[model samples]
Target chain A: MTGVRLYFRYLGVSFRSQLQYPASFIMMTVGHLVVTAIEFFGLWALFDRFGSLGDWALAEVALFYGMVHVAFAIAEAAARGFDVLHRHVRTGDFDRILLRPRSTVLQVMGLEFQLMRIGRFTQGFVVLIWGISKVGIVWTLPKYLLMALSILGGCFLFVGLFVLQAVLSFWSVDSLEVVNLTTYGGVETAKVPIAIYKGWFRRFFTWIIPLATINYFPLMAVLDHQDPLNTPLWLSWLSPFFGIAFFTMSLQVWKMGLKYYHSTGS
Target chain B: MAQIVVRDLTKVFKVAHRKAGVWQAIKGLVKREYNPVRALDGVSFEVGRGELVGYLGPNGAGKSTTVKILSGILVPDSGLCKIINRIPWQERAAHVQDIGVVFGQRSQLWWDLPVMDSFELLRDIYRLGPVDFNDTLEELVETLNLSAFLGVPVRQLSLGQRMRCELTASLLHRPKLLFLDEPTIGLDAVSKLVVRDFIKRLNKEHGTTILLTTHDMDDVEALCHRVMIIGRGQILMEGKLKDIRQRFARERRFIVELGNRYVEEEVKGRISKAELIYLEGNQAHFNFDPTIVTPAELLHELSAEFEVRDVLIENPPIDEVIARLYEELAI
Candidate 1:
């Protein structure tokens, strides 16, 4: 079988094992939906009190929030194995992956598929539809395609960050709070317009990490808005490609990490 | 031809050193101290194809390190290792495709999935064709008797049952080489016998070259004709099992149960070239050099002296031989 087909087979087994505890799965899913709903409500209350922040209206901020949360949810569901890779390394389970005749990345990618994240994904989708309706922008075919591309790009970016986190386990099997600063903290910062941040902060996400390429620039292109930072309009249209590049780079780093892997003692 | 050749392989580990107090832990964060320990020091050995070689060593003797390097999970610091003419760590994927490893302390099967589910996943991972997979699975199932619990989840199975399934899982690809690290470490006598029998048969029938690291002497004695003893990261002895025993088999133990209590002096005067090591109410133990006095001569003298109700003769245990070897070699 091909790697892709084997990946799906691993995912199928993971889903079945998780569903064996139906009650716990349902409870966790409901809990995820409720917590994200309250978080969005808190954002709505702030907007209700202040109408606009830094010249961006509530609907524009909601579009950013919805896009970031939706992409994050998808990445969290698919890349959970990387998110908790320290446990596998510490417990010596990573040795079993080495014994198999497949790429370690493919095996780790298929290690987990968290279906409960669908609850958070649904909430984000609902908020996105509500924001689009309230914004009153004429929706063209290109605009719709751009929006889909932005979500895909954002998912790829977050998954890349998670893969990088797992790669760090080769050197140290600690909790890796530093990588989380980029992943979880990046989600909160990307929910707002990158133009509002200071120059270096915005540049860190734009040039160094390219997180803004997935959401901020693509959103501007789709919303037909001008860059307050004076970036060329053509640059904004090419932002989505950053996700693919980042993902490819992370896979290379993962391969290097495998070479340096010091498997736990038996 | 030799299926595996390891020449002067060595590995050193830099372990962090920290004191117990919280103040020391705080100091460690600034500039940590590291102590270098040699886990494997110029170890070398060879195993021919279809040879079931027993790898023996006490704890902290680098047995597991050798297995990890041979199985391609670790890169040695120096020296050459070639399994089937391929460098293991350099071409890991291709090398591991023909090798199977099982660590008794760890389970390769999925914790929450059924035994057969893990097998099917391995089938996909190894890319075994349907027909080949089925034939191998059927043969292993028959040999290992895994049909009863194939549908049961791994979490609910006992250790023995889980180990049986693990053995079957590793063999599904029909790997030419097998590395078993303490394969029968904590099994009951019956389970150990079953596993040992299966391994012996597998080696004979399929010509699978197996290198087993085990602490169980029975496992070593039952399945291995050739044994390699390693200590302190070096091969101390490697030869046929009987040859090592004969080399160290100098003393014999004799236990005699008397019909009535006897004085120590009375027994001591009757025996020659034999020392009475221990004496209880009606039982006595003797350690005698077989070269000095034959067993028939000693037994005849003992029978003439005491009312010997029972007598048992035994060679010194293998554990004693190994412990003495370790001490004598200072490993």
Candidate 2:
């Protein structure tokens, strides 16, 4: 409990520091907002010309895109510490974390806050609301709970990927592009339904990274949307948990990698 | 009883190496090579309770490797390291609770936060109590003279002020053992003295065992009771500072000024065992082997030849002494 409380305090401290220069903070947040808005608008234009993607309208596809991006933004904010692990390892900043009495995971999590990700959050949230109005899903207590869980579970899945990338920093500081593929690729794949992709691509994401379990399956239950996969409603409700499980397992790998932590740079 | 003990510590690092040039870079892209560096080889040492020892070495002589192993930050390939009855690497979180560390090259403080804010964060990090933490902070701040810039961000503080803050940060928990890696590097003369005095006091008062690693021989001369000189992954010398100086540096410096002014040629012939190093304007400098000619004999020979106004004999500076020692060790 104390560790968690201290982690929150560290988060607050990081946020305040990033806000020290108001002009810079506002510029960065606006920059993030504009870049993501333009990217999403490009997708919107593509759907505008085609009218519908295999009977799935832009609004229907927006549900997946917005939810996946929303979860990613939250994970990026929470795992900002892991995002800079490469520099930390190369520069020997990781030694400071080891010297502390707290858990290494908590210490690294407290390293940064990345408050500018709020721009991405805001854009995704607005799109989610827009998608909700167009789709007109029947409101229920369970559906409301599933919506919250699906987003949070998706956040954990991305957090797991971030942790995995950070673990690779221990062995080699230069080769990180491959892990970036999984995280960004996971977001891109989970945004739309899996029907568009076939064969190995679908299996690679659904079984290997397991992003679809937390995002696509849980989201389908919330939308009452049918798919070719024919995943049971009860299974979809339980699939969000697999994301949390993946996060737990990734932390274990992080522990194993720490033993190989050959500290560098004096 | 010894508070820290290590036996046969060894570590080898596989460093990927490539020659310079675009062709080499392209070759490295295809096929890479690694050079294994033996950072530590069968090293062994011990520090008893409250002993402030200096771990001396040239660059890349495994000084930091030993410190890292002792502090539980790095795992050795094969070794037995027990600190306060616990293996550091096996019980890192617990072992670190009783130890403090300061890396002069790195800043543990947040760049944007005030000095006090970082201290408060450390308080919660070590789970220090409100009353105990305040008392320690008050005493450290007052002694280190940090009150003037306590509220300023760390980036704004001078290097001297930053070092003081780093010392305070490491000691907030009152750790039993402290590892300071070049703590006084790049500080002004006055700051150096202040830090040296504080370290001496911290050891004497708190009974803290300290392992100091530094390039500044003045720091070692001022603080360390015992010194260990490491070279090429091995200890070349270890003993009391006085004994090491006496054993390695047996040459004495002699200077004489003649009573008759502007008699540069007053002493033409050299003394039996003394070699004149510099002679100009009625003053002469000679370096004599102490075992062959005593200071009194050299002075007697000087007065017999020229009308000596005064005579002075002294030992060489510690920096020169250690430089010669390093040359002899061929590190």
Candidate 3:
């Protein structure tokens, strides 16, 4: 509880610092909104031509897009410490964090609050609510709870990916573009049903990175659609569990990276 | 029992040697070689609680490596080290709770946040109770004269102001031991004096044990009670600053201005003992060993022989003294 409280305080500091530059904050937020909107429009155009993507309707895809972006935005806002890890490494600012009498993970998570992501978050919420209304799905309390859990799970998974990217900075200072393919590309690929992808691609993301567990399987249960792959009904609902498991494993990697930091001297 | 102890603390770093040019860079990925660089070689030291020790060294002399190991930032390959009955690397988080570190090259204050906000954040990080937090904050703010800059963002403050805030941030938890690495680097004369006075006060008032590292000789002279000079990952000299100066003290130079320039064949006693090093523009530099010839006696005899206007004594630089020590020790 104390850790969470202190993290909130760090977030509060970050938010206030961001608010100091109102104009820049608003401009970046708007830019985020436009960029995300354009990506969604490309999906909408694809649906217009094909009418649906491998048994997935536009509303279904919107549901996936909205949830992934929402989770991603939350992670981006909170895990920006990891996002700018290179700057901290180069400037020896990480030394300051180490000197503090707090968990380094919490301190880094609270490193920065990108207020500009509010724009992407706001747009995601609008798309999510619209998709739910248009899909005409039966809403039960458990299903609603599952939806919330799925978002949380997705947020944790995305944050894990961010953590992994940040840890790689210890070895190489330059941020690689391949990591973005996993994060940004993961989001793009998850929007559609995993069935749309080839056998190799689907297996890679599902088994290796586990991107499919956040959206595809959970959406299947919510939509009451029978999956051709014959994954058990209980297993489909357990998609979020995989995300939590992966996050726990990534925590070990983060610890190893920290030990490396001490040895190398940042 | 030693509050801090170390034996044969050696740290060897494997650094990948990279060649210049794009083609060489491409080739490096396929074939790379790493060379071992020993930053600390069997270097050892011990300090009792509440003792303020100044660590001095030239650049890349492994001064920081020692500080890092003691502060639990790095682990030596082979060494027995402890701080307050705890191994620093093994019990890093616990060991660091009672220790504060400040790197003069870096600032701990939040760049975009006010100084007060940074302090409040630190209070939370340390999990200090409201009473203790407020007391320490008040004391630091008052002693450091930080009330004026409390509301200002760190980026907006001057270097001196930022440094004060940094010191306050590090000390918010009231660590028993403080490690200051080049804490006075780049400060102006006034700021340096204020910092030195504050450190002295911090030591005397709270009995905060301090270990400082610096290249500035004045910092050693003004603040350090005991100085340890290290070079090539080894201690070259360690003793009282005044005592070390006496050991390597050179002949003092005296520049005399004559009322009138005269081609004197010889001065009575002055020419006999002193080396008249330079003579130009009605002035001369006399290098005289104070042990051999008293400066007063030489000045009086020289005045009797020639008209004298003014005289000034020059103390050679402490850097020269340290350089000579390095040559003698081959460190």
Candidate 4:
């Protein structure tokens, strides 16, 4: 309970510290807003010209895009510390985390909750509301529950991905950039419908990284149709749970990394 | 039964090999080589309750490795270690709750936050009660004289002010044991004295057992009850500063200042026991063993022959004692 409370306190402190430089904070927030706006426009233009990707409409694609960015922005703010672990390990600042009496997971999570990432979040939120309004689907308690669960599951998945990326810093700091394929690459793939991709790509997202479980499976359950791969409704509904399972597994790897770090004493 | 105990604590590190030049770097990438360096070799020691022990060693001499292990940050390859009756590495969070650590080379406070914010964060990290937290903070802040910069961000403060804040950061939880690794390194004279004074009072008043590792001999002299001199991954010697000095360097010095009427000629000859090490103008330096002949007899004999204006006696400086000890051990 204290860890959760402390995590929020760290967020509060981090927000105030970033406010110390108002100009930089304002500029970066605007940059994030502008950069994400451009990305949305690019996605919007493609749907405007082609009408849709395969059978999926712009409203549905907008839902996919919005859900991905919203969860990503939250994860970006929450996982800023893990995202910058390479620099921390290189500078020997990671030792500071170990010295603290709290769990390393909580310390790293609380390192930063960036306010600028809210710009990206705002854009995603607007698109999401617009997509939901246009979808014309009947509202149900389970559907509402599914939407919230899917977004939260996405957050957990992204946090896990961030932790996985950071785990490599324990052994070697070289070529850690390659792990971006799963983290940043996960974001790119999840923004589009899974059915649009080939069979192997879909399976890779579903099995290897579990990106499909959080975005595609839940979205299909919402649309009331079997995706191109014919995923069952029950499977789609349970897919968000798989994302949570993946989160716990990622933490297991984190444990191994910490043990290796202790033994190395570097 | 001691507050801190260790037996055969050892740690080894593997350093990867990378030679100069771009060609070698690329070739080395394909076939990397590693060299095993033993950082700690069969190092052992114990610190009783409320005992202030100083661990002294040169760079790469395992001073930090030992501190790291004891502070619950690093695990040794093989060792039986316990702090406050708990194995630090096995029960890290709980064990660290009873200890505080500060590394002089690094700042534990948040760079952008004010000093107080960092302290509050630490309070939450340790889950300290508000009353106990504030009590320790009040005492540390007042004693360390950190109220002036308490509101200022850490990066904006001077090194001295920041160091004072760092001390408060570690002690806010009132840990029974404190590990200070070079807590006074690179400070000016006044800051050094303030820090030394604070350390002295903390041990005296709180009975907090402190393990200090520093290059400054003055810190050891002013604070430590006992000292351990480590070199090349092992403890060369450990004892009181005076005892170590007597063992390593028994030869004491005597000085005689001749009156204005006398010249350097009167003080050039050897005395009965002391050796005339140097004769410059009217003052003379004589090296003698205190056991063989006392400074009083040397002064008396010099006064009988020469018109001695003034005389004084002194032991070797602490710096010389450590240097001689290091030399004798060939570390």
Question: Which should have the higher DockQ, number 1 or number 3?
Answer: 1
Q: Every prediction's TM-score for the first chain?
A: 0.96, 0.95, 0.96, 0.96
Tens-place lDDT per residue, model 1, B62-85, is 998899889888888999999999
Model 2: docking quality category: medium
Q: Write candidate 4's Cα lDDT for B1-331 as tens digits.
A: 5999998988999998888999988877578789998888989899998889999987889999999899877899998899989998889888888888889999899999889899998888888899999888988888988888889999999888888998898888888999999999989999999999998888889998999999899898888889998888888899997788789879887777877544445555535678887777777777888998888888878777777888767776788778888888988
RMSD of each: 1.8, 2.1, 2.5, 2.9
Write down the DockQ of candidate 1: 0.62
TM-scores of all candidate predictions against the true structure:
0.96, 0.96, 0.94, 0.92
Candidate 2: misplaced stretches above 4 Å?
A: A262-266, B26-31, B259-269
Error of 3 at A201 (Å): 1.1
**Runs of candidate 3 exceeding 4 Å displacement:** B259-280, B296-314, B327-331
What's the best-to-worst order under DockQ?
Answer: 1, 3, 4, 2
**Candidate lDDT (C-alpha), each:** 0.87, 0.87, 0.84, 0.86
- Candidate 3 chain A lowest-lDDT run of ten: A169-178
Best by TM-score: 1
Q: Give me the displacement of residue B57 in model 1, in angstroms.
A: 0.5
User: Could you give candidate 4's per-residue lDDT for residues A178-208 as a string of tens digits?
Assistant: 7888777888888889778888988888888
Show model 1 residue runs off by greater than 4 Å.
A262-266, B263-270
Q: Residue B54 deviation, candidate 1, in Å?
A: 0.7
**Model 3, residue B48: C-alpha shift (Å):** 2.6
Native-to-model Cα distance after best TM-score fit, residue B309 in candidate 1, in Å: 3.5
Query: What stretches of model 4 exceed 4 Å from their correct place?
Result: A136-141, B26-31, B255-288, B291-311
Instruction: Rank all candidate structures by their lDDT, best first, as comma-separated numbers.
Output: 1, 2, 4, 3
